[model samples]
Target chain A: MADSFSLMQEQYAKILQTYLQEKNEIGLYHAQQFSKKVLENQISPEEVVSLHLDAIEKFFPDLPQGARDSFEFLLEVMMGYGMAYREHQSLRDKQKELETEINVAANMQQTFLPKEIPSVDSLDVGVISVPASKMSGDYYHFVKDENNCIGVAIADIIGKGVPAALCMSMIKYAMDSLPEQRLQPGALLENLNRVVEQNVASNMFITMMYGSYDPRVHHFYYSGAGHEPGFYYNYKTDSFEELYAKGLVLGITRDTTFREYHKKVEPGDFIVLLSDGVTECRTDEGFIEREELTRFIHQYKHLPAQEIVNNVFYQLEKLQGFQLRDDFSLIILRRKV
Target chain B: MSVQSNVEVRTEWGIVSARQAGRNLAKEIGFSSVDQARITTAISELARNIYLYAEKGEIIIEAVEEIHSTGVKHGIKITAKDKGPGIKNIRQVMEDGFTTSGGLGAGLPGVKRLMDEFDIDSVAGEGTEITTIKWNS
Candidate 1:
């Protein structure tokens, strides 16, 4: 009986509150009818006053009395709540629209990239890529020509998100437009620099390591523009070698030059290319040292290329507490022993 | 720090992957060879359930450690989740001889027997999630 009595009291308070908030005649009429029904149920006038006072205290503590009419004060408060609620609703809708647009852009960017890694009978290729968010700053591309010479390019932009995604697509289009110049690493970098300097924003830059492998000559000619130095594993010596080249980052200056270096490729030699994400992985103590990465590569060099990449990724993920702070891209090309 | 892995079970290959992942995590956490096989069989059963009922789902493998007044205990936890037709009568389904999809009907009961802890939550129209844990002595 007490529960039913309090339930009716609460319902009456809600109806009165809604009438004041919405200023609708139907709500006011409903409130009047319910109050009449409460009186008929033998609820005393003192009990009604107490229930109303409790509702007022809980819903509006700072309501001023006598300085302004109670109804007028409620009108002001209701208008404020209505405006704030509308603003919140509109902001939520705008956020949802923005998220949908970003998803669309991400899907469009994916279409501009290669669907799968190209197959070359002489090279066993494996790649692993993970973006830090919806978009990535790292780029890896493979271009094969009629003569079976393959061009391998890996790059990292300075920034992230939509701008970086756009810059990567621009680089892909530039590479696709110039297959004739693919064999010359130095000249190709120069022409790409000109394109970047003219087209890309002045504040942005890209670091790249581009190499051309000629299966017939068993040689890899490469150029680097302020990019990470890749490692080469020699099967006979069981040692890792770093391939270094000196050059300036692209989109910086028009006259900057890139120098090409050549290495003789042998059977069982593996080329490993990666962005700084691999080299800068963090641990409890500090960033993992470069020498540790070198030793890790040598330890897992005997595994299939894909397994080596996955093991490294999982180990690094474990070290970093299962989170990646930046975009990661790794490519391994091995000549079968 | 703990080690974890995930396998999506939609095909026979996925069941194999979940089984292998369970065995690997068990071995890493120092579970005995006998316990490793038990863990593998339990995960395979869960993965098979996903493939047969939901057609697609995921299995998560985790390495866990708990420390208290007694000492430290290391264990492995496997969780299987699916958005399929939820079980209507959980009590009847848990019986050893009851079969819904008509095999030996021993999967869930055997899973409960093999692990130290087993839990399941299901909503009639929503989905189901089952988790099991095994500890190393």
Candidate 2:
């Protein structure tokens, strides 16, 4: 550090001598080059001012005391700014480190999601999930039993970032361990609630919906944990109704009971499940009403289940001016008997 | 006594500056650490709203004193103004679990809860302005 300072000082002194003698652009150019070198050595502005003062004193020993004192005042002001600049640089480095770590966490969360949507003979299923940010606060899982009964679960964590990603992994493992409960949506939610209440923080809660489709009975049994209500389209009535189940969000209490509901599925009928990202989609005018969403669904209802979901998503995405504010996840199940 | 600070809300750094300014003013006004956090959190939400919705806006922080019948009260007032597309439905946005951004749906309602007084005026195309104040208790 001392060697660099002396080297810079010698160069600065030479520049000052030439600039004072000639007062030309060439001399000014050298001074600019010297300034660049000083910055490369991380020299503070106050230090540069001090070096200039020293150069002036060396050239003229009779320099006025008042003029020198004014330079000293400028040095003091630069010192405060110099300190703030250094602090700002350190903070920027820390922010970069944190962003890199979040990217890693986001990658790990992706692995926790279902690798492929499970194929069931009696059911045609379509699912789509998009995160508003790198880290998603929403998750979904699929399990297929020996009898071909497909269990589908969708959950939204009431938080964001790394913590939400971590909670999602825990939930995925917990559901994996409880294979027996998958066929029973009500029991599944009850067991998961206990797990969440025990492992998660008190302030953090999860809203979830679980459903199992039995092809033999053509019954769609489902349960909820304070999640958004899904829609049941009655082909006979050509109408839609809310699929409501009474329950509290997970992690709220040690022992919370979830009520199971069922609707017999007929050919051409379907069920729609989604996060608030779909139901509460917003545009410049206002939120997209639930009725409008139904109309959108009906328009594409004749298409394959997958096409239906994709088209609806594109429509809503466009309505929100191509920017989604929340994580969007939607699932559609149609019986193919 | 009134001391004011203005932060431009055009980028992420703007939101951070607004929060820091709010925290400093709240602390200077003799608020407890909890209240300081609340004030900063509210500032963050409001400032973020500006950046996300309007693309560019401003956050103004001021230390204010209110004269009441009982006594004089110290408080901090924050105003977030933007000329971007205004909110069309203030009532709907105020409900919990209502968010367009993939957040916790705790946008406007959360801000309202964090401060003592909240007022919002917005027109569909003209602009939007939100003012909130928290008194030191």
Score every model by TM-score.
Answer: 0.56, 0.59
Q: What's the lDDT for all of these models?
A: 0.79, 0.84
Evaluated on chain B only, what is the TM-score of candidate 1? 0.92
Candidate 1 chain A weakest lDDT stretch, 10 residues = A76-85
Tell me the TM-score of chain B in each candidate. 0.92, 0.94
Candidate 2 chain A — worst ten consecutive residues by lDDT sum?
Answer: A79-88
Per-residue lDDT of candidate 1, residues A196-301 (tens digit): 8999999889989998888888798999899888899888898888878799999899988889999888999988889988888888889998788877777788
Per-candidate clash tally? 0, 5
Which residue pairs clash in candidate 1? none
**DockQ scores for all the models shown?**
0.01, 0.01
Candidate 2: C-alpha lDDT:
0.84
Model 2 lDDT tens row, A147-239: 888899999887765677778888998888886644489999999999999999998889999999888889999999999898998887989
